[model samples]
Structures are given as C-alpha cells and as structure tokens.
Target: MSSRYAFTKTVKELRSFLTRAYPIMKKNNPHVPILIREGTGALPRVYARYDLGQEQTCSLEGLSDKQIEETVTSLVKPTSL
Candidate 1:
C-alpha cells in the first residue's frame, strides 16, 4: 500500500502495522498466504480467501491501524466458542 493518497497517514500506519504483523500472522495461520503489494494507484484493501473459492475483503482506505487490525483479525483469526 502506497501512502501518497489523501489518507496517507492512516495508510502508512496500516503499512507499518502489517510489516510487523505479517510474520506473526503467517506463523499463526500457516496455510494462509499474505500478499502485500506496494505501488501507486492502489487502494488499501485486505483479501481473505476461504474454501470453495470464497473470498472476503475489507477496505482499509482511511482506517487507523487499530481499526485495520481489528478488521483483519476478525476476518482471518479463528474465534473460540
């Protein structure tokens, strides 16, 4: 995610959070693949793939790091009953 847009600060925060969280995410979710692309003209978004070709997404455009993390954790992390 590039931070050149209007929501630069939030996006940067997200990027930094992802940088630190990526490894932990991978370790916890070994079967999941996380792809991070940095470039211009790309909206901040997260995609989670599940069985049967199903996919979920969350827009991170102007969200703070905490919000981003919450959204991601809810999407990717398995919850206990």
Candidate 2:
C-alpha cells in the first residue's frame, strides 16, 4: 500500500470508530498520512492507497468500533511477510 489512507463519515453509527481509530492509526503509523471526509452521505468505507496508483476499498457499514479499528490497523500496519 501507499503511504496514505482515507475514511468516509456519513452515518452517525461510524462516529465513534472514526474518532478513535483515526488518531490511533495516525500515531501507530506516523509515516502514513490519514485523511477523513465528512458529510458525503456515502456508505461508510475505508480506503487504502497502494503503489502504481492502485487502491483498495472496504465497506464498514455494519462494523462496530472495535471491528473498524482492527480493519484500519491491519491496513495501515500490515504484517511483514
């Protein structure tokens, strides 16, 4: 993945996850930039930017705060293979 990521904020149910995960994701992965977009009325989603302009999108419509946090963390700080 590239050194950046983004998240969408349109639903009230995602507020807590976005708030808590965003900061921790920033702190844990200082080299990667984190971005947030609000008021889009889009379905909750997480985006991971990758090399060669490739990107990945994941749905977070039904995930809890903990689940969302885990998903974001995994994307931002992937395990070394």
Candidate 3:
C-alpha cells in the first residue's frame, strides 16, 4: 500500500476509535480537554493532546492492532485518582 493510503487509513481508524472513546474520556476527565491530531508518518502517526499543554504522540506504529488499541486507550485515558 502507498504511504499516503496507510497514513489516511490509520488516521481514519483512529478518528473512529476516538469518537467512541470521547464520552468515556469526558466522563473521566471532564475538566480536561482531549484532542487527537495526525502526526507526520506513513503509518499511524497519531498524537493525543490532553488538557491544554500535555501532548502524547502515539508510539504504537508497526505494532499489532491489539497493541495499538491498548496504547491509544492508555494514552488518551487519564490515570485513576
């Protein structure tokens, strides 16, 4: 597959995943703002910007789907108090 296709696909999938996750995140971290942005790469180069200043670049590139899911979930979701 072309690099562009891969990147687009990755971001699209990530968007879908995040849409489902947003409600849960809002409930968990209502005071914090969460946003996901596409990063530079052919693969899933996605970043999650949390609150206002904290940013988390997904490091799940080249990993399995399950691993990526777990990584994204952990990255966007805040730790328990």
The clash numbers for all candidates, in the given order, read: 0, 0, 0
TM for every model, in the order presented, reads 0.78, 0.65, 0.54
State candidate 3's TM-score. Answer: 0.54
Clashing pairs in 2: none
Error of 3 at 65 (Å): 6.8
Please give, for residues 1-81, the per-residue lDDT of candidate 1 as tens digits.
454556677668888888888889899879766788876667878888877687888898788778888998888676432
Name the top lDDT candidate.
Answer: 1
**After superposing candidate 1, which stretches have Cα over 4 Å from the reference?**
1-5, 77-81
For candidate 2, lDDT tens digit of each residue in 1-81?
Answer: 221123332244478876666677678778987777765546677899877686778888767677777777677665442
lDDT by candidate, in order shown: 0.78, 0.67, 0.64
Q: Please state the error at residue 76 of candidate 2 in Å.
A: 3.0
The superposed Cα distance between candidate 1 and the true structure at residue 6, in angstroms, equals: 2.4
Summarize candidate 3's per-residue lDDT along 10-81 as a digit string, tens digits. 566666666776788789879976555555754555577656587667655545555667886777567632
Ranking by lDDT: 1, 2, 3
